[model samples]
Structures are given as C-alpha cells and as structure tokens.
Target: MRQMAVIAPVAMVMVGGLSGCDAAQPTDSRFAPDYQGVETTLLDGDLVKFDVAMQGARGPVDVENYAECAAAQYALIRGYGFARHLRTNVYEEAGLWRGDAVYTISPALPRGVRTIDAEVVTASCVENGIPMV
Candidate 1:
C-alpha cells in the first residue's frame, strides 16, 4: 500500500509534465497554415522567399516542413503549378529558431530539389499533416 501511494504521485507528475508540452498540430490536411506570423518577400521575377517562426519544441526539420508547405501553397495561388527549392537558412537567435526558405515558382517544375507538383506537394503536406498557406 505504501509503494502504491508513492507510484501514484510519480505517475501524476509524469502526466502533468507531458500535458505541459506545447507541441501543436494541424487538425486536417487542408487546414491553412498559421502564416499570420510568417514573413514573406517577393524578389525579382518568380523568386519568393519566406521566413517562418519556429514554434516551441519545433526543430529545423519542422521549420523546413512549415516553409515548404507555405511555398507550395503560395505557388498554387500564383497560378504556378510548380516550384523549385532555392535555399533554406536555419538559424537560432534570442533562444528562437527561424527558417528562411526561398523558392521560385513556374508553370512547369524548375530544376532544384526535384520537381514540385502542386497537387503532389499539397498532398504531401496533407500526408505529412502540415498546414498549407
């Protein structure tokens, strides 16, 4: 009975700790991204760039995924069915991690990071359970 009492408190503490984790996920594949906080820029031609704020407990991969989702959605909105991944800058500052991704949109998939099909890209986002712009 004494051992059970000690285990009960320990289990409660573990559950409480897990509940405090701040990781969040999209409700569905078609869910729009929380791009309200993301910054975007349009360079010369079809070059588009974005910087997304990494949420708590998110790492570089997560940031990359977020950027990719936004880029894909942006291209689709621009009437471009494809995009080429230019580059992504991942950095940390002030205890926050950020990802700056660049891509070029076109009617046909450009060279780089493989061909990006708008439909497949969006589907990939959905499969990955990431939000689109």
Candidate 2:
C-alpha cells in the first residue's frame, strides 16, 4: 500500500510534465510568413542609396545625422535580412536619420516584417566628445 501511493504521485507528475512540454511547441505556417525581399530605389542617380522607413519609440528617424544613422543602418540590414553585394552611406536631415545604404532590396519583402526596431544613438549629448545626460 505504501509503495503504491508513492508510485501514483510520481506517475501523475510525469504525465503533467509531458503535457506542459507539448504545449510549448511552435505552431504551423499560420504564424510564419513566406519571405522574399524588399524594394530598393535611387534617391539620387548613381549616388548608391536606398530609403527605408521604420517606426521608433520616439518617431521617424532623422537620417541626415551620424550616430542615429549608423543605428538605423544596423537595424535595416538585420531586420530585412538582405543578401550580400550591398553596402551603404548613412545620413540625416531635418532631424530624420536616413541610411543611404547600398543594398538591393526586392520590390517588397515577402516575410512581411514591417517594423525595424533600432536603438537611437545620438551625438547631441556630447560635451568635450563625451556623452552627457
């Protein structure tokens, strides 16, 4: 009787554990997107540029600057998952950071990942070349 009681609890625990693990598995294609690529165009003829717009916690990027420009570059390249044979020059203007990055995105990305999350790094807080505040 004592051995039976111990085995019953152990068996129940094992069953519960198995059930939990099964629920943790990923779902089918309903949640996945069929990825292809994104569209690219020229801002200036042969200046070698592509324009990408992504939402940030603050607002649209000011690509005319430098640091935020770099961060934006990192975000787009990683977020869109573009191929090689591409490079870039990032810039900002009117408080919007832009990446004139050199890459050939398709007409549109099939994966359907809309937003690229990028941390805003800026030089505006510089005092003697050190970031303040």
Candidate 3:
C-alpha cells in the first residue's frame, strides 16, 4: 500500500511534466511587415534578376523569400511553370531590407536542386500575404 501511494504521486508528477511539454510557445504579435515592391530585369533569355525591398523584416530570410515569391510569379506570368534559383544577395540598411536575386525560368523543371513550381509558390505567397510582380 505504501509503494502504491508513492507510485501514484510520481505518476501524477510525470504526467504534469509531460503536459507542460506540449504547451504552445508564445509568439511575437508585434510583427508587422511592409512589402515595398519588386523590380525585375531581364538579363538574358530565361535568366531574370529580381530586386525586392521591404520594411519591418525579421531577417534576411524574409527579404530572400520576397525575392523568391517575385521570381515564382514572374515565371508564371511568362508562361513558364518552373523556376530555378541561382543566387540571392540580401542586405539591410537602416530599417529597410533588400534582396537581389537571380533565377532561371523554364517551361519544365530546370536542372537544379533549388527549383520551385510557379503555381505552388505563387499560391503559398498569396496565402502568406506576400506581394509579387
């Protein structure tokens, strides 16, 4: 009976600990992002350059994502179904973030690991409230 009593308390404590582990972490609700715009330049056939700017970005990743979303939408507008990521340069100055990215648009899946389906990426961008041009 004494062992049973001790085991009951221990089991209760373990269950409480496990329940706490599943608790949701707090997120910052002050995250307000402003997407400036995107400027696209055609370097050559199938090769395109995207310049994107934004404000209130959390980090370089946000700027890069803006450029990526632009590339994906551009590919779709050009009647291409796929875009291959080439490179992206991200920088922040004062309170503004900018990304200079290059991508290759193709009718079919391009020859690269960093490839994106235009339709899928554009859908995700729209769902995430990201602007594209």
Candidate 4:
C-alpha cells in the first residue's frame, strides 16, 4: 500500500516526462520548420562557433534563432551565463536553413555588441519554439 503510493507517483512522473519529451529528433513532418542539430567548434581564445541546420520549410530567421539557442545552451554547459555574438551567416539551400554563429562566452556580460544572457536566451528559445542541443 505505502510502496504502491510512492511508486505510483514516480511511475506517473516518469511516464509523463517520457511522453512529453520534446528533445528527440522528430521524424513527423507535422513539426515542420524543425531543428535538426548543431555542430560546435572551439576556436582560439574563448570563442566557439556553432553551425546549426534545420530541415523543412523554415526560414533564415528560424535557423539563426536555432543557432543562437545552441550557443546559449553551450555557454550554460561550459559554466557561463553570457554569450557575446560575434557574427552569423544565414543561408538556405536545397530546402534547408543553415546558420554559422560565433560567440564568446564569459561569466559577466561581454562588453561587446549583441551580448546575450544565456539563461534568458535559453528560456526565450523554449518560448520561441527553437530546439536546443
């Protein structure tokens, strides 16, 4: 009885979490304009470049936002709270949108152009429907 009460909630939470998981690679076309994945490269100094691509009928703005989300998540993984956007090149080819974004990570907001709070950016990404990796 007591064991069932404890296990029931745990099981329910686990099932809910799994069924509601939104991070998986989506195969259905219903989620069009979907985020595919991200490629990251550590550059000289504290800069990291993220190349993000997506499939479907998305636009350049979507791809750029997805890349920025990747950068924000990466900054958080690296124990940083801010990312300074250096540059980004967005393009579309063969029905795919790809963006190459460069960012510098720092604990404090970088005194440069387009500095982003990683936590804020990540939250905004979730709200804007941009997938992060």
Candidate 5:
C-alpha cells in the first residue's frame, strides 16, 4: 500500500506536467510590435519634440522607447553627441500607442541623470529593430 501511494502520486504529477505542455502557447503575433511612424518638431534651439506612434506595444514603456530612439537619431543628425530627456507623455487608445516626448540635444553631455549618448543609443536602437528619425 505504501509503494502504491507513492507511485500514484508520482504518476499523477508526471501526467499533470505532460498535460501542461500540451496547453496552448502564446503566439509571436501577441507580442510583436508594429512601429507606425515618428514626427519631429523643433521646439527651440536645442530642445526638440518627438511625436511617435505604434501598434501592438506591450505598454507605455514601448512608446517611450520609440520616442527615445527618435531623440537619439535626431541628436546625431544635428551633430550633437548627447541628449537629455526632458519630459514624455504616453497615451493609448484602442490598440494604438502614442508618445509626445521632449529632449535637449547638446554637443557635450547634458547635466541630467536621464542623459543618453546619441551614438550609443542610436546603435542600440538599430540593433533592437527600433525606428528612429
């Protein structure tokens, strides 16, 4: 009876594990991101605004990342070596996500904790398949 009890529990666990493996797994399309586009606006001399949109984003962080990628590329295009994040506003409606972000481009590192090296950030964005201006 002792051996039978142990074997039954072990068999039940094994069957449970195998059944779990047969359960439906999440598809790639569920998490795949779709980058819509980006719009750039020069707010002031070194201050710039990035309006970015995307679909199938996981959350606001994805939208913010899109804005960051745009800022990085814009800084590089303007011959700036660094950028400082000023502010960002993220919104989602239905399945579309939008980010309105502002950043400051400078030839040298800006005085802020949210600063980014344009060259480095741009390279990372490209590697991660993120779109930039």
Candidate 6:
C-alpha cells in the first residue's frame, strides 16, 4: 500500500513532465523579407510548397524566382550536413531556361529546427540578356 502511494506520485510526475514538453510544437518555415538572392522577375517567381510529410510540422514556403529558390534548397541541404539530422532529397524540374525554377523539398523535419535560410548565388534570368533572378 505504501509502495503504491509512492509509485502513483512518481508516475504522475513523469506524465506531467512529458506533457509539458513540446514534442509536437508547430515549426515555422516562413522566411522573412530581405532573404538572400530573393527577387522578382518576369515569371513573377517560382512556387514552393512543402512535401506531404513536411506540411504541418515544418510548414510551407514559397519563392518568387527559380534561381534563388533552387540555390536556397541546395544551401539548406548542405547546411543540414553540418547538423546531421534526417534528410530529404530535393530535385529541380525544367524551369531555369524558361526563366523559372521549380523544386521539391520533402520528408518533414524533426522538432527544434524551424526555418532554413539559404543564400542565392545564381540569378538565371534578367532583362538585359539573362541576369540572375
């Protein structure tokens, strides 16, 4: 009976502690203005959507241009190599030559990591004969 009383309190405490933890806290992947390599162009910028797995927890994001969008994705993957968390394969569709770039990011991210900002190095389209976007 005495042991039961002690065990009850201990179990309650453990449960309480776990409930307080934010194992399921929502993550924000929205990027702020002034992001590197972000710009507006003729195509009006590419669209970025989170993969099915990444939809809720990690959130979704959109980019206006393909060059910056693709580079940002590349930088994000390369950046994650430093942290060594779970990874998602990102690939590009045919868009650059047409003055746009489309990419797919997937597999959701674990808790803790929220937004990833990647610098855009190449501007594939421009008014004066193909400047970077």
RMSD of each: 9.3, 16.6, 4.4, 14.6, 3.0, 17.3
Error of 4 at 18 (Å): 54
Q: Give the number of the best model, judged by lDDT.
A: 3
Q: Rate the local accuracy (lDDT) of all candidates.
A: 0.78, 0.36, 0.95, 0.86, 0.94, 0.34
The C-alpha TM-scores of every prediction are: 0.65, 0.26, 0.79, 0.72, 0.81, 0.24
When sorted by lDDT, best at the front, the candidate numbers are 3, 5, 4, 1, 2, 6
Which model, 3 or 5, shows the larger lDDT? 3
* Tens-place lDDT digits, model 2, residues 12-41: 999999877845657553412111122354
- Among all windows of 10 consecutive residues in model 2, the one with the lowest summed lDDT is 124-133
Q: How much is 119 displaced in model 3, in angstroms?
A: 0.2
Number of clashing residue pairs, candidate 6: 6
Q: Judged by TM-score relative to the true structure, which candidate is superior, 1 or 5?
A: 5
- lDDT of candidate 6 over 49-128, digit per residue (tens): 22211111111122223343443444344342111122333332332112233332223332345322342222222221
Model 4, range 8-95, lDDT digits (tens) per residue?
9999999999989778676755655767789999997679999988887446677778888998999999999999988999988888
Q: Which stretches of candidate 6 lie over 4 Å from their true place?
A: 30-133
* Superposed Cα deviation of residue 72, candidate 3 (Å): 0.7
User: What TM-score number comes out for model 4?
Assistant: 0.72
Worst 10 residues of 1 by lDDT: 28-37
Q: What residue runs in model 2 are displaced by over 4 Å at the alpha carbon? A: 22-47, 52-99, 102-133
Tens digits of lDDT, candidate 5, 2-61: 999999999999999998786686777656799999999998899999999999999999
- Can you write out model 3's per-residue Cα lDDT over 60-113, one digit (the tens) per residue? 999988999999999999999999999999999999998999999999998889
Best candidate, TM-score-wise?
5
- Location of the lowest summed lDDT over 10 successive residues in candidate 3: 22-31
